[model samples]
Target: MPVRPLSPELAEKARNELNETDENKMVDSLQHLKDWLAKQPYLKARTDDQWLAAFLRGCKFSLERTKQKIDLFYTLKKTAPELTPLKYKDPKFSEILDLGVSIVLPKTSNPAEPRILLMRPGLYDPNKYSLGDVMSVGAVIQNIMLMDDDNFVVAGGISIIDLQGCTMAHFAQMNPMLMKKMTVAFQEAAPVRMKGVHYLNTPPGFETIFNFIKGFLNEKNKKRLYVHNTDFESLYKYLPKEVLPTEYGGNAGTAREFTENTKKKILEYSAWLDEEHLYGTEESKRPGKPKTAEELFGVEGSFRQLQKVIMIRELSPDLAHIAKTELNEDPKQTPEDIKHLREWIMKQTHLKARTDHQWLVAMLRGCKFSLERVKEKLDLYYTLRTTSPEVTLRLKPTQPTFINFLRLGTCIILPKATTGLHPRVILIRAGRYDPEKNSVADIMCILYYMVQILVMEDDSATVIGTKIVVDYEGTTLNHLVQANVTLLRKIVAVSQDSLPLRLKGSHHLNVPSGIETIFKLVSAFISEKAKQRLKIHKSADELFEHIPKDVMPPEYGGNGATVAENIEYWITKIREYKSWMEVEERLGTDESRRLGSLPSDEAGDKGSFRQLNID
Candidate 1:
């Protein structure tokens, strides 16, 4: 059902109290708010009139207050994700929704009355559900009022808390910091005007906590506080039985009925609810220092312990020549240029990241100091890490799972660059790991880490790009089967989009006959530019002709370090950056805070990998 219009009495109250006398003025103000929202860089806010109107009336058409409330309203979700993500699939949310823990009572036709926000915390098991879950569910009900109930918006609402079966655990969940977030969420974020709060069936020791909590409440709420303690007669003076649930001896449907309908009403506005989580303040663009969760909610500090990353800034004469000629990198200006990019990244609201000088410098060198392209590269780099955790966010370096895989020597980054141009060489041994025990994706994960190590520390890899050599010496039907279109496409997308390592050449060696069938399937997915750089070597002579002897590992009769030695080197390197990875693992796009379209062609080929020309 559509939201019912306010009766004449309520409409007149809005005109007098809310300063909504001039219809033309309200339209102009709404348009002005929309215009202001358009100019904001961080907030992907909703533009609907009904949505914007709630904030306006909540402040009685005071433009400045409305702006502050609007910022806080969206900022609540961004700062307090624990209580803000009240999605439909959350089982705890659904369970509480069914329990009738918090439900709005049926609005009576008496148009002057405000909406009733009923809360029964005693309905839920304190041990099974935390206070955050209850408040998240309650947020949904409160927001439903902000959207659907005119009386709730214009006349405001009252809250009734029935502390019947509550335990000490319930009180413990309402810690100081949590209380602040919940307060900001309900009051400033939702901006529901509170008429009064009546506490029913108050347990022993409730007064102390309640009085302490009064400090967080406004002056208006402190006066409106009432403790009824199971006295329905006393409560009846303030709230008539018609507006209360049957459990409270009212004529309205039972609490279950109200809950079922409230859930349905929530489903009705589900789209708006989903979008609400996406819109929030760009704290970076805020007037003062960007608000951290600590600043916003007074919770624990938001700093992470990261070890200093040792950056190898020294470049060899050969690599320096290649860097300037092939990569367009001028050594003189790169240090200052890296600082500029770092400053830009610090100001970004979406990139909640603190990268070291090496990583930022690597990005600049990879994109050859094109500021725009480097920004794009870093954004996608973090986006994939944040958005695709299972595939890319593997940061546990000391864990046995990754450590064991590193010893397999399936993927190795040769320390020596090729002669002349000094491009780093990475060798991927296709047959090193048994396909039954390890899939292609597993090895790809190892390759992913190795390439990350290459770009961050190696000047040649960052500036002149890296050469990828895949040697399929041990060919099998099972290995080919693992190289399905889906897995290969993700591998290709990661190679093409996310990684900062530019591809100087892609060389394939020792290809078995059945691999031809696999190559045909993979050819359709790789980019045309990547396809042009492709080189298939039939013999050791042909492969050696493309990659010099010094660049090849000792296993291949080159001066480069043996596979085992390189694996040990990487194992030690991975251990050194464990702390750094712990912090970088948290740095990914929230997706919700992005201002415009997703960073261009982000996942590379996206869902249309098959729609490509094959030769």
Candidate 2:
């Protein structure tokens, strides 16, 4: 959680418009809203304090407007479940997501820079997934961005709707009522400040859909909409090509690649989307009579039109060839392999393992489809969880201390992995440690959680091994004292013997003077084979020879994103899997159910293990 420094321009805007120039005012505003909302019985949705502050900021710190928008936000969820559905896992919704209809661009010029959302309705099939589904997918993406405190709150958003191949049939398929619902939801319910909407290459008869949509938008937003009919030059006047994707004559990757990456992100945050669905207003529990859909929107039959026949888009020869190549190159496990692995695990009565296909596939891929190895790893994996309560039971991610440790960016899994080996890179900012707050056990717990998540996310490339970059720029003798030798041994033992991953390479960057003593103490516990893979680099430039700079964060003179942004991405991902992690507490090998007794040397004595200190 790096503190986003407010630009002078943004600071002035906050002072003049929102009257919130400092932390104290923001805190007071948030507290005021929380107290006000506590008295509103109808507003049942669990509101985050940070989100409340965002709402206040959006409304220029006007409490009355904020309250109104909050009420309408939950109300829209109840009335427009079609577009604001409770879940994104629905098959049709997922299809739209997979089709790459809409995506939020990755890089922003600055912290206060507005995000550009690119939408290509021409590439999708309206017959298979409706226009409402497209809007729903976009809404989900917007909601996820809104959760980012720095990106959406400080900066706003802009949209580029490419209508190059839109046909009259597509317009006929559009449900005006659904369009109205989506428009109202975006304008009133969502906290996003839509700076503008650019329509690219608008085809003939596009006015039919445009007019219908504009009828619902407010005058302010209606003025913000721009129709650029085939004039890329004019569109570039408003949005520079530097910020746009290559397909749109921008520097980023191809539009197809951007869309695919966006789909992956949507899937990564699906759990968060599902949790959001639960926070909406529970209409059934309302004290007053709930408003009916018909009463709210008037007779819906007025906006109904003849449903046109759905048709799938035909891919061009180049795109078709690329799709084929991608399908072949994808390293994900096949359906048949997943099925076989699931069946094999279930049939192994001695293992007493009950797991999903995903978990099994991860293990199988880690072992390169070796069932015996996967089984062994699975047994050890669950055994460690069941036996070592300190690592699994006491490692609660929701705890404040754990979250603070995570925010320190002490350890993060880079988005991209190594090129040749494709092992996921785990960057450990050892210099960021504060021994006063975090102990050796705390560090071990965090490492355990990171490895657990990395293994789960790993495929063939990353599962086999992982690359670790340790930064020891700020090491002191006190830090070495905090690194308990006993705990270090336990961590190394479990990683080597139980975990399925291999330590492919370990690069120590920014090694402080006399830090070799600390490494010597810790290395004594690690095996010689592991020690052989470790390299001590005095500079990031030296480390770049072994680990490519492209995959490393920019803070280390790499081409990738800033360290803060990368850390934020992983934090959001960790929060998304919070529920699953909680369930994992009960998921471990059942020693009582095993056929044979535990091994004498391997098994822990009944009362020898130390007790976990829960804060």
**Which one wins on lDDT?**
1
Q: Rate the local accuracy (lDDT) of all candidates.
A: 0.74, 0.66
Per-residue accuracy of model 1 over 9-108 as CA lDDT, tens digit each: 8789889889977667678888899899887776667777777788888899988898888877777767787775556658878998899899888865
* lDDT minimum window of 10 residues, candidate 2: 306-315
Once fitted onto the true fold, the runs of candidate 1 whose alpha carbons sit more than 4 angstroms away are: 1-5, 285-288, 299-615
Q: Tens-digit lDDT track for model 2 on 421-450?
A: 356678888768787866556655676677
Q: Candidate 2: list runs displaced more than 4 Å.
A: 1-12, 109-111, 267-270, 284-289, 300-615
Best by TM-score: 1
Model 2 TM = 0.46
**Model 1: lDDT to the true structure:** 0.74
Relative to the unseen true structure, what is the C-alpha lDDT of residue 571 in candidate 2, on a scale of 0 to 100? 76
Q: How many backbone collisions does model 1 have?
A: 0
